[model samples]
Target chain A: MTIEQIRKTFDSFLEEHLAFGQPEGLYEPLHYLMKQGGKRLRPLLLLLATGLYDDRFERGLHAALAVELFHNFTLAHDDIMDEAATRRGKPTIYKKYGLPSGILTGDLALIYAYEQLVMGLPASLAIRLMAIFNGFAVDVCRGQQLDMEFEMREHIRMEEYLQMIAWKTAVLPAGALQIGALIGGASEEEAAILHRFGLQLGLAFQLQDDWLDTFGDEQKTGKRKGGDILQQKKTALVVYVLEHGSPEQARHLLEALKSDELQDAEKIAAVQGFLEVSGAKAAIDELQRKYTREALAQLASLNLPEARLQPLKMLAEELMGRKG
Target chain B: MTIEQIRKTFDSFLEEHLAFGQPEGLYEPLHYLMKQGGKRLRPLLLLLATGLYDDRFERGLHAALAVELFHNFTLAHDDIMDEAATRRGKPTIYKKYGLPSGILTGDLALIYAYEQLVMGLPASLAIRLMAIFNGFAVDVCRGQQLDMEFEMREHIRMEEYLQMIAWKTAVLPAGALQIGALIGGASEEEAAILHRFGLQLGLAFQLQDDWLDTFGDEQKTGKRKGGDILQQKKTALVVYVLEHGSPEQARHLLEALKSDELQDAEKIAAVQGFLEVSGAKAAIDELQRKYTREALAQLASLNLPEARLQPLKMLAEELMGRKG
Candidate 1:
């Protein structure tokens, strides 16, 4: 049940088994993007949850892989849409392989995710998994579409951003956890509780991500410092400052957001200064802690033996405080 | 059995039962792309094949829609890869929504195609459908990857081109007809026969498309005359010409392909001239006729009443010869 043990197992599964076919130029970009490491957190969570109940974790490996592959698929396609040139300090799949290959590879990943999900489940369970898997995919698309719409808008409400991320980033993990529980022979109540636990964890995870983009150690995060600030992203921190700042302070923040000529350091300092005075950082910290606490509480409410749930609780705490 | 009736049934089924949440931007690009006009030949084939048994073709509407939607999904992504600005005289989905939304919409379409298949079949049949659907999707991706490889090669072999096209464009329709037959309660042997029927028709359909690109009247075909020649596509005609043309003609063809300096009209005429003189036109025409006759013959060989399959036979004849 140790987090390290769970991650080791997941990585071995990916490395040994995920050898998809190449379609010349089309596959290289997607392959390149996926090979660039993420934390492998989503799939790890599913494995941990499944292992929580049954010792038979390997049976659910394809389900976990399905989530990871789908996550990478979204990343590849989103990079193309956002015109992002690099991911994790290297060229993005689209940049490396061009738009068509990026699109096709992303597509292959998605279709293959479904293929993997169907490999191990019983017929009735497979239908349920199909519904869950397909629903996650459709919601991710909906969220990306909304994210695009947000880009063109002059202002975005906090609720809208939360809803968007819930659809885009949160639900896949939640759905995956549910599938993991189902496959592991957990009762329906246990499955629903676990699903909520993963979702809340995801929400907190995303908020922490937004916070790290501004204040994180560049060595750990491996992104250009203040990158989101330079882009004038309508993130949670910005939304909080805009809604709560004094009238004059709000005007300064708005002017800074709209000004294209501000230097990178100056922009970051200006926005950070405004957010500090507005107490936006404190508000976000409080909100993040609330969600994290709620997620842990949900985990504790599961009637499963505490020893079985020990690894998940430790993993959740680490995720909340993670620097990268 | 009428095409108009089949279209109506498919449209009604899609509108009434897709179970898709009305997300704001999710379906916009797909709606835009699907509404643009083309002959819905793939779906029509499924409906016609179903009619070969009984008027229970209505039960197969969602399955047929899956085929068409999957086709358009590939088209949308392919347009992005090919950098095609226009499709059917309108801007393609990528050009309209940009790569991110285009990619997301295409992914959504592919998943929804699976959903439609699941919904249209019984649980027992749904499991079988997923098995077939997964294999078809993987093959399509591999074909697309190989096609990108073809674009970069100076002299792609004819066998490779056929393999690529069979995987890329032909297999889905081939699978779709068989799925239709299965949905309508045809035996495994009967389904296999219809599958061969569809595959042959698909091959002839693609070959005829290649022929029409150069030889059809510009006024009748919406596409610009000699469009494939201008693009230097390694089509069947070009392959034949490259293999059989005299040394001087081959050199001219190579020069046209390598040099961007040749004016569009001049390049088109040069390629056309080489095709004619080398008898590549006659050779390809004979090949197209061979497949067409074989496809119709396969249709006749199906152990069904003649009246039941007459509509499909007529549709194939029109498809092979029609300019638009």
Candidate 2:
């Protein structure tokens, strides 16, 4: 089946399983946030990686739900921690219900994610899955912690910034692919390669996102250009300037970011000019391309038929492509 | 070894395992809360239960840490949800670190819980333990949800209140005993009996706590008399008055509870009279005794040697006996 069909099948299963709890307030926010929709990228990665080794899509459904619910759980709590009002263009659990609901919903989702993981599996597989999933969870938590701490500080090293992004955004896809590959009978070595493939894909995807938020066409991206600049988010572009720009250029960009009086449009324009002059924009664009290329190379390192590799290749390109 | 030895070993193992993660803010709260210790009762029950079958306190240390961490995770988040300022006579994570840390700390502790659960076990036991822990977690979440919802409404059925109390306060100890018994090679039937034993013990423990807060001697209990009454908590006694009292009595009880004009001492005295006249105090006390009796009966049904069962028997009586 295609990824679309897998998504459809997964959604039906998820809807049936998710609403089984009592206390209406506890589970409703889960359904409400999930219904708002997302790329369903993590689950798809798991399913596709499973397909690459063997057809266990039926059993893989449990794993697919595990990653999906885990992702949503992070989003629910991250929204609360970030004080985010909306996600996927919908009001966050915090905004929609209250702080208590936000905390509880995230918790229930995380526990349920574990339930789905070991639902019908044999003992050995369940043990392996639990270990991998738990590590992935800890990495994400550490990433979020670093990100929150970074918000209060004036400077962050490029190495530290990359680790934060990898933990926060990249590990889910990487772990999903690795988990699915192992479940489908891949050797540990093969699973490691698949995880690397996903890691690069995830990094490229996030870097491209940072680039598009300021540089892409609003019509094509369907988002206002400079959204990141308006929020003063320390995206890859901002981090690049901090690492590589001249002192005057870095100071100018930082001042513009901290300035409340500057109009949003003018700030965006000025930051864009700084990005261009500092060579930061081109460097990050090159970095995104490099990761995309490395991801494909990792995919090629596997001895699978070209047809089996086609879906992952197309997805990496779609996510990292300049067209957004 | 005695329960004291088990707790000390468990503490050392827990400290070594818990502080491994980084980004100081994320892990420090866990350390802080764990240090401000309680009775360590759940882990004690687990270790003693393990002793009842085979002495595996070494391996049971992991299970002990899992339950202890799970309990603290609940406390950390529940404090935020309840807007509580202190736990175990110390400022709570919410009071000390703020809301985001409270949420994130709980999230990390819970994830760490799953990590310790599967750390070094054989596949089958780990699988069984995971399922049990996950179910226990969901029940507590549902219980907390109900408790929070109850605060917003005026009336709740006795049955509903019991379910909430059982879910919130009973499952941790129950699950701990069940897990440890199974690990020590108890049969499914044996584990079930142990679980039921812990369940009743937990209920009696919590009910006795409520009774003590309102009805026991402050000098002996070491808590202010009528503390729960002061908080206007809808505990079992209050639920009984609402369930069985005359309309005028129930109305007066509730009005006195809600009235700000009543002196604290006068309000406590008035509420005590309603409880006596309505038989809520006696009924709840009887209910607590029933649970305690049934719990001992469950322990007796287990065919373990008398010497093997002595520790748990003594502990139960220590917790449930009215001597204090």
TM-score (all chains, Cα) for each model: 0.93, 0.98
| TM-score leader | 2
Put down candidate 2 lDDT per residue, B1-324, tens digits, no spaces.
765677788777776877556788888877887778888889889888888888766767788888988999999999999999987689999799888888888888898888888767889888889989998999999999999999998888899988998999998899999998988889989999999999998998888888887889877777788887889998899889888887777788889888899899999998888888789989989999999999999999999889889888887887787536
Model 2: how far residue B230 lies from native, Å = 1.8
Interface RMSD of each: 1.9, 1.0
Q: Which runs in model 1 stand beyond 4 Å of their true positions?
A: A20-30, A217-225, A260-262, B15-23, B218-224, B246-248, B256-267
For model 2, how does the per-residue alpha-carbon lDDT over A1-324 read when each residue is reduced to its tens digit?
Answer: 776787898888878877566878787887886677888889888988888888766668888898988998999899988889988788998799898888898898899899998878888988888888988899999999899998887677778888988999899999999988988889999999999998888888888889999888888888889988888888888888887877776788889888888788889998888888888789888998999899999999999999988877776776776564
lDDT of each model, Cα atoms only?
0.79, 0.86
User: What's the DockQ of model 2?
Assistant: 0.85
Off by over 4 Å in 2: A322-324
- The count of backbone overlaps in candidate 1 is 0
What TM-score does structure 2 among the candidates reach?
0.98
Candidate whose DockQ is highest: 2
Retained native contacts per candidate, as fractions? Answer: 0.73, 0.90
List the pairs of residues colliding in candidate 1.
Answer: none
**How is the predicted docking of candidate 1 categorized under the CAPRI scheme?**
medium
Best by lDDT: 2
